[model samples]
Target: MKLKLAAAMLAASLPLASMAFAQGTAPADLAMIDACLKTAEKTGGFGGACVGLVADPCIKAAKGANDDVAKWKACAARELAIWTQKTSEALKKVQAGGFTDVIQAVNDSQKTFAASRDRFCAVFDKIEPGMYPGDASYCRLRETANHSLSLIKLGAAVNEH
Candidate 1:
């Protein structure tokens, strides 16, 4: 029957759909990484080099570092430091403005954003208990970088108004 054939096709496609979702970084993030890599390759600047190197450990870990807990811990610590510094500087800049309602909103939103970042990273912990710290560190790094960029754009817009 037509109905039975349609149901079977949908069932067969479910795994493929899941596989696609599970593979690779999101498109925007991939673009950002590619940009960073290109800059590092071209200029050899510290910022670009740092961002470019963040994934090296992960790639190594994928090959075998998963078996070496120490390496993961080190990578996680390094990433957390980068995330903390970037987020702190971004928040400070956004908060340094005049005591207006917009500034207050930005401050409140930052507190909320920090909480959200923790919760979002916690999902990685939930998925792989053993790799939690490393996984969460990478998540935090990506989220913080994105947040910093957003705050920078917001600050520019506020200044423009």
Candidate 2:
């Protein structure tokens, strides 16, 4: 009877777990981003700012470029580089202390995240047709920044465990 109850409970929770995972960005993450933006606005520094904080200036620059494709591309490149470097460093930190399974999971998740980012950003191409590079770059920057932040937090959690 105990075993049956356990199995039933597990089955019931599966959908809830799936829903959380399917949402991609949880409410907590959105809250964090909002808090970070507020803090960044108040402080004008990256000290306690969230992952997107690093890309904030680049985004601003892109917007200020007045639709100049070259300028927008430049800002996008900078933002991408920042995201890539930070994510790589965080992943390495996690890998250094994680077990084999943990390391493998992190590796697999990063790849999956990258693929998802690309596909998600591709939608922006159609949103503003003919703005190919700029629109796509903006989407990539936002996605990469958010992913980098999540990876950093994940690394901290892994280290804690």
Candidate 3:
């Protein structure tokens, strides 16, 4: 667990992946988003720079601005994996902080967030086009990422005690 947390914090400090505009070039990997997340945390905001970091560059790499739609879904999935793992690790960090009240509150909120995510993403499913699948995936990704940040912040609060 400590190793996972250490790796995550280390990854967050790494620089963002440089975007290449040429076709057939996606991010070499998803670690770039970690840098973006760290930036978001530093600035006390969540979605600004981190948003579209993956998909935009991916589309450009795929075939430029008019790239295939599949690129969007693929990029979303990849970034989602990264964010999901981060969120999970952050939650674990909080769980180990040893505040019973904080733990109980976090557990409660996590349960609520899970239900909320399902409904929120399902709403996107009702939209037209291939939006349902991709939209839902992005929704889950965004929700999970936000939840992860919130947990990290919560852990900080616990530390302050």
Candidate 4:
């Protein structure tokens, strides 16, 4: 009985122990975005700068802009949905895995959210206020990207749990 109680105590403490291992990626991610925005401004153009931000992993830290913007949005949305779903899975995993339970799920969700934000930021910056070419498409992409950012923020919040 004592042994069993000891084991249960150890199990209960695992999540809190692992939570200590979670590090903040916010500063680095924001720095990358800032750098990308700077590069975009320096490039002296809207489209190229935006695309550059999307492509540079160091800056965007996520890659998925290769496909058409519409397809990309669909993919990102799906990816985020999976991350959100996995949060519960993470909790369950933590309950069972002892320590590694929620780690993967939280990390996966964070990565997806970051990627979504980067994709959206890239596309959002491209839509100049007065640009004539593909104005409607630009608007749509911007909306999609904004939605992705929202998901990313939500994921980030969930990670705190």
Top candidate on lDDT is 3
TM per model? 0.53, 0.57, 0.65, 0.24
TM-score of 3: 0.65
**C-alpha RMSD for every candidate:** 17.0, 14.2, 8.3, 16.0
Candidate 1 structure quality by residue, lDDT tens digits, 1-161: 32233223322322322232235334554555556645744674434344524545553664453465445544554444443444444455555554477666765665466557767776875566365545665566566556655665555456554
Winner on TM-score between 1 and 4 is: 1
Q: Which parts of model 3 are misplaced by more than 4 Å?
A: 1-30, 41-48, 59-69, 129-133
Deviation of model 4 at 161, angstroms:
2.5
lDDT of each: 0.50, 0.54, 0.58, 0.35
Please provide, for model 2 over 1-161, each residue's C-alpha lDDT reduced to its tens digit, 9 standing for 90 to 100: 32233223322322322232234433444465557645754675432356544344545565643556556545454445554445556676677665678777766665456557667877876765335545666567667666666666666667875
Worst 10 residues of 1 by lDDT: 9-18
Better of 3 and 4 by TM-score: 3
Q: Please give the distance, in angstroms, between residue 101's alpha carbon in candidate 2 and its true position after superposition.
A: 2.6
What are the runs in model 1 whose C-alpha is more than 4 Å off? 1-52, 55-66, 128-133, 159-161
The better-scoring model by lDDT among 1 and 3 is 3
Best by TM-score: 3
